[model samples]
Target: MTHVLNRIILTAILALFAVQANAMWIQPDWYEVTQPGVGTNRYAYSGNDPINNFDPLGNDFSKAPGDYDFSEEGAAREEAEMQNRDLDGVTDGIIIDKSIGHLSSGPGRYRSTQKYLEAVASGKIGPQNSEISRKEALANIRDLGEQFEQRSLVCDASCEAMVPGPGQTSAIGASVAVVGGVAAGTNSIPTRGKFKGSTPGTSPASIAARQAFGNTRIPGNVRLPAPTAKAPLQTSNRVGTVVGRIGPIGAVVGGAIVGTQVIRRDSQVLQCMSSCYSTGFLDR
Candidate 1:
């Protein structure tokens, strides 16, 4: 019975030592400095829920097992989708501004052109992933071409006034010259000589015109493969195009009406001034 008691005591001592060795081996040397309460327990792993959360690097808990995927293909597809969405957003804004906001169309076109150039440089306008179909890619290119055409038209009409060609005078410039000449009682107010031959390609308006011409022809230059399936026509895009076409007409009519009002107001002011002068009110 004494021998049996000795054996029992020896077994208990070995078990205690084994438990201590296991604890020492598994306990972490470092703690989470960011979380003081949790850092106090160096042995804590994944908020003490090892089965639900994993912390392989002894940092924060990772997403629940199988909850999130981290892969190159997935990331690429996501980026491509985001780019396509951005392009769509820009297209929508341009359509709305061109159709309903004609007064601010110049700025709208400028903004859209910048966005298009960015998208092109980033390779966002073309098919970036397998998720985008050929038809969708073609449509994106077509939209870009249309935007370029619109910008070209706007630049032709307005940018000339900003940076007129050599020897070419803008209507506003001509009107000012004529008025100044009349006031000074001289016909020697030099009219800008007629367009003198070729304009240098380095000029701002010339460069813009060249860029617009090149961009407008991009769709024709690209050789896209035939789409496997036919894409349905989008009615909203058709409607927007129609409205954009009509916007300029509306703008012209509105300008005429405003011009008439301005003329009448100017006539009234002149009559008042004449009466004031005749009554010697000007002398007072």
Candidate 2:
């Protein structure tokens, strides 16, 4: 009995180590738009990368990179000149690139779906990992626009789910998707023809509505509206306008007018809501 127990403990330890070995988490540097004022702006990259020689800042900014090898001296000088150009320039927004990983050697331990599947079979990951991966894959596929073009959904404002009709619902839907998850702010994407601008702190039901259009089967006779432009929110409320302000009121009225005419007017609001939820899977 003692020997058997010893063997079991050894096996458990080995399993734990194996699981840890298979688990991988990484932080990548991403870009953001830094608008100084109305028209002047610059770019900033956050996160760590030995290639770029950046140190983690504890917070997102802490791990940011400052310098990059500029191919042209003129380009390099130009960027430097804009670093603090017109100190009071408005920071319009940041443009982020895809996450980049570090160099790895030796069989490239983490490679191929087959290896991931093996890890699952070996009890390295709970089924939840598989589910998450599947969902991510589906989302990526949707973003690529391939899944949308294949579907035959009607892109008309009169669609029962999109707009209220004789026997249909009137409430429209929308969604928000933060670029880098919760750490990132809520971001809106326009629905097929419903919305024309970005709505911060939006609702989840709206997000579902946008996804619904992506899956809706529209006929050829009906037309889908173009996606609306999204306006970035002022990060600090100290200097800004409220929904009740004259400017804000005008915007609201304008939005409603445009939204009413678009097919996916609610898409931005729904996506913004999903982006702001700040917890759990957006779909859930």
Candidate 2 regions with alpha-carbon error over 4 angstroms: 1-256, 260-268, 271-273, 281-284
Q: What is the TM-score of each candidate against the true structure?
A: 0.16, 0.14
Q: Which candidate ranks first by TM-score, i.e. highest? A: 1
Candidate 2: residue 185 lDDT (0-100): 23
User: Model 1 over residues 169-219: C-alpha lDDT tens digits?
Assistant: 233234333333322332122324522112222223223334433434323
Write one digit per residue (lDDT tens) for candidate 2, span 163-213: 333211212211112111221222233444443233432323324334433
Alpha carbon lDDT of each predicted model: 0.30, 0.26
Error of 2 at 151 (Å): 19
lDDT for predicted candidate 1 compared with the true structure: 0.30
Instruction: Indicate the residue-level lDDT of 199 in model 1.
Output: 26
